[model samples]
Target: MAARKKWYSQGLRFSCTGCGYCCSGRPGYVYVNDEEIAQISQYLGLETAEFLSRFTRETHRERSLNERPNGDCVFLDPISRSCRIYPLRPRQCRTFPFWNSNLRRPRDWEDVCRTCPGCGKGPVFSYETIEELRRVIDL
Candidate 1:
């Protein structure tokens, strides 16, 4: 049997402020599967091959969106602080603070919140809502 999940009794609240903090200040993998890459490529009006060559790097044999040397995600708009291809962004980008890792412990959530002003603010989400995001289903 699987271990039960630890849930936040207080529920959770968050809203993206378009601050770009999530897209900036860290070199981390934005892991993307083929379906996501195709979606993003179509959104950007690029051929899949061109998109793969320009926007991603091979990460342990899987593809992940590359970040600039300064740590900003390649699609993070310098002026607007918005994702360039918001609608077709990878599932990893859509999940945000609702990921299973972030929801596992109170301190884990707080730890992530330090870098993300959006993590603990704005509209509250019920347990079910958060669970949906964590499951990587429709957002």
Candidate 2:
């Protein structure tokens, strides 16, 4: 059977402009698993336990990166507005704008593009690529 066409079936453009808009001004989860915690800890030269204590918080029995009082991600540098642990960032962080919540419908994608400058600004991601990314983190 042929698959139904989605609003973004033609593909979507996205290239992180690094404005940090997505990283701040909103309180949301950047959920990380045990393996991600370990990698981020090693990248920062901190012990796993120390990293978890200082950078993560538990809510609803799941672990996620901490956010600043004003709602910026803890790893978001106040000055540069870039992630401190970009390379080892969790899978959730790696998949941005491609999240299911954002791609579920055209309206959702429109909402995301409003805040995320990266959306509609760069390479065109085919539906196949977008679907693959959406599967990476069940967001």
Best by TM-score: 2
Give candidate 1's error at residue 46 in angstroms: 1.3
Off by over 4 Å in 1: 1-5, 137-139
Top candidate by lDDT: 2
| Clashing residue pairs, backbone N/CA/C < 3 A, model 2 | none
Q: Residue-wise lDDT of candidate 2 within 20-126, one digit each (tens)?
A: 88788979888999999888999999999999999999988589999999999999999999988998888887888899999988999999998887898888999
Give the TM-score of each candidate. 0.89, 0.96
lDDT of 1 by residue, 1-139 (tens): 9866566755798999889987889688888998998889998899999999999999875788989999999999888889998988888888887887787779999998998988889999887788778899322
- Model 2: per-residue Cα lDDT at residue 40: 90
The weakest ten consecutive residues by lDDT in model 2 span 17-26
Tell me the lDDT of model 1 at 69. 93
